[model samples]
Target: MPGRALPVGLCPDMCPAAERDLRERERRLHRLELAPGCPGDPPRADPQRAVKEYSRPAAGKPRPPPSQLRPPPVLLATVRYLAGEVAESAGASPAEVVGFVADRLRAVRMDLALQAAGDAEATVVLEAALATLLAVVARLGPDDVRGPVDPVLLQTQVQESFGSLRRCYARGAGTRPRQAAFQGLFLLYNLGSVQALREVLQLPASLRACPALRTALAIDAAFREGNAARFFRLLRTLPYLQSCAVQGHVGLARRAALARLARALSTPKGQPLPLGFVVHLLALDGPQEARGLCQAHGLPVDEEGRVVFLRGRYAEEGRPPASACRVLVGSKLQGRTLEEVVMAEEEDEGVQAPRTMQEGDAPSPRVPGLAQTI
Candidate 1:
């Protein structure tokens, strides 16, 4: 084999030294393929696993402790401003105040979400912030505040904020009283939805017994049953903040109730219903608003200020009268500024506890003169 030349490609297999060199070359290629960034068939690896590894903190460089984390400076400032100066400002219209507050609260919420992770104190702050925001939003009626933001969008934000607050409560972040109150408000705001009622029913017996929640449940029942009389009656009993929470739905409730009335009262020869009766039934400000509402829905008003309901003539058109019944709900604020109305908790420590009812107990009597007014 030394004297005779081996086949060109067979030398490595035929000679020991050639075979050793070939083995060494193969080993070098294998090592090169395994090295970082070297061009070869990439190692089969899970992409998610790689991402997790990359995202993980480097060894010996742990994350800062939750105790060291503080809320953003802007968040603190904004909250203080909202609670103090803005709350007391008398010159700004309700819409303007709410729009500004909404913008600031949105920023505060975003900052809290980023910085409040794992920090109990910061989470509590977030709860308060959300509560304040919800309160501000609840103060405005559905059509009362209009601008770039749609009224429906504001309601959506309220729902989202309340949901976040509930999540916080589930983690034991907010006080029970505040959470209970907001839960009731949530039910009232979503009066027409069965889901809201289901959520309320699923609550603990103690929470379900809160006065606000109880009233909310009654209102929901009346609304679902299309009992306009009972719906307006129950509506008159809500506290100022609760009224704000429920005000957004008042127009819809009124429209639906008016439709029912039209269907029931309409006759071949139009029937004349007193404007005063419509006012009492809908809790409107007075005869003028009642007339407006009747006209809005295509009903005719007579010289004597009576609405003529004609069969097959009721048109489901026109906007409902703007809420003008300040005496019923808005006046309940009793000269308190919007901020005080919003930020004040009904059951603060050392304050009187909310009235709780037993399962079989009847609701407290309605304001005596309210019924007579009708």
Candidate 2:
């Protein structure tokens, strides 16, 4: 009896093993409604737990385990279901499948730059998280989608969030339905990949049907390619970006750049502004007649609306045929009057006190008969 070991099951496993079992069982079981007496297994974080970990295989990394590729088909099937659900409920809950894909994707490698490791990691994690959304959306097509992944806050931790990306289901309990699709579109727009954009465009006609964001994306693409008319056309079509107040600065910037070019193109400039030459840059091939002129500092327009150039003057008679002084709007004269405009100096006069703010320098509030709104 002294030489023999206690029976395996009869022996005490000791403190360490017992403690581990105690810790592992700390989770609470999920309660079920339909099953009555049945208790669901406790939620175990394990791999699903968000962790700040990621790796890219050396120069040529080996493939991920078979489990990595498991999400595509399954998530794709869920998207197929969502296509019909939107008509009834806007979007169904198979969205859960997208979470399934997103949670695991955080483990995948991405082609991120090492120098900006933290920022890049943040971007990739969000991307992987959002990529799952695409699989579910792929079934609906791009037309039906409308909305952004994140709401515009006066201040947010980041323009888009990395945290929302780590968990596939932050949208689960109180998640908004159209949010995933809207976010997917925003991410796609910023990707800068024309081919990828085309892929996004291939989504269901329903998802693709939304012109609001699509119009904005089109404007962005046109601007990136430097196609002014296309950019203006898209802006005119949607009209939402004006209030987006989110990208207003960016919109104003592009408008300024294009306005300068339009001025040069319509005028008899002694020389052409170099950057303005690539009018067809964005693959937008339209004739000179197809172009329209907008006032300076004025929001761009396709119609003769209440828009006024910041100079607070009336819009010119439809981009004055073709002229020389039109090299750019003679905006330098906006707040000045002919009588007040400083002309030639009678050099013979010592009467010029150190030109202080004279009556001539005072700004006039309105320039009489201007038809435009500031």
Index of the highest-TM-score prediction:
1
Task: Name the regions of candidate 2 deviating beyond 4 angstroms.
Answer: 1-156, 162-177, 184-205, 236-374
> Candidate 1: which stretches are off by over 4 Å?
1-77, 87-93, 116-146, 173-175, 347-374
Compared with the true structure, all predictions reach lDDT values of 0.60, 0.30
lDDT of 2 at 147: 29
lDDT of 2 by residue, 1-374 (tens): 24533221111211123322343377421111012333445433222121212234566665333222223222222222222222123233333322332222333222121212233233333443333333332222122222222213211312223334423323344333343334334533343557546655655555444443344355455456554443433333221112121122233334444454444333332222222222222111222311332333232333423222333222333323221111111222345321111111112111111112123221123222211211
Model 2 per-residue lDDT at 99: 30
**Top candidate, metric lDDT:** 1
